[model samples]
Target: MNFFKKLFGKKTGSSNGANQGRANFSGVYSTEHFNERYNEFSLEKDMLDGCLKMIEGYFIDNQIERIIEGPVNHPANLDQVDQSGFGFVLYCQAFELSEGEATMFLAFAFSDYLITKYGFKLYKDQKPDHPLRGMTLKYDKDGVVLSLYPFEYTVKVLKGNETFSALEEKLKANLKELPKVDELLKNFGIGGDK
Candidate 1:
């Protein structure tokens, strides 16, 4: 019934084979497993889009700036809180949303933006004991893989110690470094050496 419940519910996928065309994978994980992972992503795409629309509605209703830039540091926005909903105190105060709702809203909205703007893919890592065992964003560029936890970044910013603009800027800087690494490999004849 709650918004967070809808956005963060169990992963679901169709039985029809939906992973037949994927080719961007760069990890050691089997292609079969990667394809399996994609099934869930495919199913969640529409739901995530709907969630974004809901956030957009909230933005318009509240007259809050739709752009993702601002300080998240209010006195009550401490990182220390219940695991179920943490670091959303500032958002709750500013937007008049509950901790759980704010957490889900910010996580989905920002993560979706990063994925769309930067070509990252939604990934659900099912490996036990892995660092990225839950929802993650992954970018694979010519065998170079970058795994990101945008939700974790969101949580940190919402703790009132950082700003969303700073996070976006940091990501932009880091993305610039990836191409340099690729150029270095090209100069070394990584592809031609063989």
Candidate 2:
């Protein structure tokens, strides 16, 4: 308890319900609001701690010996991607997943958030968007697996995608150079610097 207070600072009650609470995360979408969108409920504090711990293990397993947290970026949500939990985006050292390789960038949005707000449709039952549901991470999942494949269509109709593309190019080019975002990602144990 004392450790969490030191790390995440104080936890505050959320107005939504008596059982729910909001944890501070001003710089990123780590608030309980967004965190709840991904983790299973166990006590707001414990869920967060678990993420932190999991992140740490990932770092060691991946051999990111020195570097800690990575940067947090909120790229505009893609129409093709689920937006509900599109809240947390962490940029880290590149890692590979069973699904595929992610180039040091990941984003998360809540499957449950979509279901509760939009209706609890299975990831497959959704509509034209059904096929795209795989891009959105489900509750209790770890990092998001990023691939531009999900945005191929959305990138066309959406405005500013060109700018986003340019920014992305620059971001990819500078992934290791960005200090604070990298540091925060390190603290979160999301990934290590390359």
> Each candidate: what lDDT?
0.47, 0.29
TM-score of each: 0.52, 0.20
Model 1: residue 187 alpha-carbon error in angstroms: 15
How well is each residue in 54-156 modelled by candidate 1, as lDDT tens digits? Answer: 4444444445542323212211111222112322344355656676566555666666666667787766656523442356766666645556565565566
- Per-prediction tally of clashes: 2, 15
Q: Model 1: clashing residue pairs?
A: 72-160, 73-160
Runs in model 1 deviating more than 4 A are 1-40, 43-46, 65-98, 128-133, 179-194
lDDT of 2 at 62: 41
Per-residue lDDT tens digits of candidate 2, residues 1-194? Answer: 00111011245566665422222332344445343433322224454344334334444544443221321122332221212221112212232232111211221212222333323222221222334323332221122111122222223223323422243343343322323445556667767963
RMSD of every candidate to native, in Å, equals 13.8, 19.7
Model 1 residue 156 CA deviation (Å) reads 1.1
